[model samples]
Target: MKSKNTMFLVQAATIGAIYVVLTLLFAPLSYGEVQVRFSEALTILPYFTPAAIPGLFVGCILSNLLGGAIPVDIIFGSIATLIGAVFTYKLRGSSKWLAPLPPIVANTVIVPFVLYYGYGVNLPIPLMMLTVGAGEVISCGIFGMIVLTALSKVKGSVFGKASYSK
Candidate 1:
């Protein structure tokens, strides 16, 4: 039991660190209107382990801090990721194809407002949604699907049997 808990913590921390590092690597592209955060690809991890929820949330918070986000973006943006991770965890057992939808949807819905109000972008809401959603689709959907496929092969080694709660 103790070892299992330790493993869970280690996995979560490692995921968080990876997320922060990836976000930092793409800082310039990640902060702007057309954000293609490579880190968003990790959002699919919740499909394999509940630990991914806190992992992704903390990672988003840390990434936002490092990215020098505004206060509203820091608060609300993290909230969006938290919500998305929770949704992903809930849908963990359904299908791998559905895993990345939570983050993509969450970011799509929330980020448009953040761009318009927080960043003071003058674009229309529909345009913001399209752009942000497209970014998420590419990052969380396309790249994330590729990652999910690769991770699925290693799920047993990384997350263990009970990790797939479905």
Candidate 2:
């Protein structure tokens, strides 16, 4: 029992750490109107374990903070990630192709507001939505699917069968 809890914590922490690293490493492309956050590729991770929900939420918060985002952007942007992660985890039993849709939709719907009001980005909301959606499609939709595919091939070896039932 103790070991299970410990493993859950470890997995969550590892995911959060990796998210921060990826976001910062691709800092230029991780934030802004025309951005493609590489860390978003890991958004598919919630499909493996529910631990990813909080991991991704905290990771987005930390990433936005370290990236010098305004308070509004930090708060709302993180919320978007939280919502997406939750939905992705909830859909774990569904088709693997659906894993990326949650984040893509969540970010596309929420990020435009963050960019326009929070960051004072001059683009129209529709334009921002288009750009942000495009980026999400690339990161969450495309790269996320790729990661999902690779992880599915080795789920037991890496994340463990225990994760699925959790």
Best by lDDT: 2
Q: Can you write out model 1's per-residue Cα lDDT over 1-166, one digit (the tens) per residue?
A: 9998998898899889998999999898677678888899999888888788888889999999988899899888888888888998888878778888999999999988998999999999788889888989998999998988887777787687644532
Off by over 4 Å in 2: 162-166
* Best-matching candidate per TM-score: 2
Task: State the displacement of the C-alpha of residue 76, model 1, in Å, after optimal TM-score superposition.
Answer: 0.9
Model 2 scores a C-alpha lDDT of 0.89
lDDT of 1: 0.87
Clashes of 2: 0
User: Which whole-number lDDT from 0 to 100 does residue 43 have in model 2?
Assistant: 94
In order, the Cα lDDT scores of the candidates are 0.87, 0.89
Q: How many angstroms is residue 144 displaced in model 2 relative to the true structure, after the best TM-score fit?
A: 0.6
Where does candidate 1 have its weakest 10-residue lDDT segment? 157-166
